[model samples]
Target: MSSETDSSLPTVAVFGLGIIGSRCADQLLNQGYHVKTWNRTPKERADSESDPISAAEGADYLAFYLKDGIALREVFSSIQNQLKPSQTVLNHSTVDLETTKWLAEQCEEIGCSFLDAPFTGSKVAAGQGALVYYVGGDSEVLESARQVLEITSKEIKPLGPVGSATVVKIATNLISASTVQALAEALAITNAYGIQPEVLTESVASNASGSVLASMKLPTMAIGDYDTHFSLENMLKDSRFALQLAGDAGLETPGIQATSAAMEAQCKKGHAHLDFSALFKAYDTA
Candidate 1:
């Protein structure tokens, strides 16, 4: 579906102008959507409102790209009364399953449609309109929001129902966190044994165990380039959410548990804002 809104496009209120949100909003605007934006911390942009309510009013779609469940609930509460049945609320933030359900309920009560649409893809992908959305909600509602979503995503995957997308997002993050940790450990062990980091990187690339995560992270980790594509703190938060999901199902997630612990330690060392690949910093002998 290709579109250019000009002034006729449905107005979309974008909350939370973080790494992904900021880029998405810009893309939406460039694509001809009437985009209103708000961030908890004020951002200096003409389209950004000073508060959530101001941003949401008169908008046909209220899209959240917030930090976590707490921020999502807080902003949602402030604007719930303003929501009408005619408006569609799309949550693009990766939040806990509990919050995903709660948001659905809140929207239900307000008689407005909602989509549990947490997405995968970080700064670069978002900027390039390549994020893949894991959508879980009413099929009709998804159709209504599809254009706005398509503006930011290369793929719009409908998983099941509300809360399912959140679970999948958290579950995938667990794999990503654990993979980086494994890469870090492998690099450390190889370096300790007098083998170069690049050798292990190459070996992993050809090995069945190799993945896109390994390819993207290993090169940067080798050079200690922890520039933030996705932050360690955010990954840590998602890992804990993954643990919660496992615990609820009476499952033992020892691997993610250990990776979560490592992330926690790294957060304490004040590396929370760095790229999640900074997990390698744990083995940084230099």
Candidate 2:
């Protein structure tokens, strides 16, 4: 909220340099934190290298925006011994509640406190430093890391214990994936009848049917401008995870089932690397 961040800014080591991670490093640097980055894949920046051990050694905060819990475990397990107990490990991956709890267990075993802090927003939100983080950890630990996190978040919701953030993340993503599926199908059906999608999208925007996601993706979907934002592969994995979560809770989730099936169909068609919005191509755009 303040232009001035807390005085206790720590040197942050960012692991994983994907769309979200790179944008995080940029914002951290913008906030004047001493930022060093390491990707599993090497980069040429002076502060970035391929070595995780060296990167983990010097920083007071280890921030990860990795693909999943397995990747998080492998990277940290390799260097967990070297990490100081005082350092905080921030996991920004959108994973299941169990995975989040399990990773937190591992971090605790190695004497480092862990924060399961998954996020929302795409590359655009990340680059603009407007990402929203759903953090599941102690209030004291959250404030301890708040200065470093503020570089990239509009809100840092401390949603109770270690698995809470991930639970929220998966639920929110289920909504997003289901919306994308419905919106894309509507566009496809309209096109099949030779009606312009522009009319449908415009009308939807004015009525109760409009959504933040539809507005963002609909224009691009109409023109087939499917530059990668969130990929189809990630969307499928997220949808399946949500459905699995619902099943685990002894609840039936028919909507998530349909959502997962649509995503699987899209991924099977070899559009996995493209944006999740590329569900537009999964339709009968033929």
RMSD of each: 1.8, 2.7
Local distance difference test, candidate 1: 0.92
Instruction: Give candidate 1 regions above 4 Å deviation.
Output: 1-5
**TM-score, prediction 1:** 0.97
Q: TM-scores of the models, in the given order?
A: 0.97, 0.93
Per-residue lDDT of model 2, residues 212-275, tens digit only = 8989888888888878888888888888788878889999989889878877887898888888
State the lDDT at 147 in candidate 1. Answer: 85
lDDT for model 2 comes to 0.83
* Alpha-carbon RMSD, candidate 2: 2.7
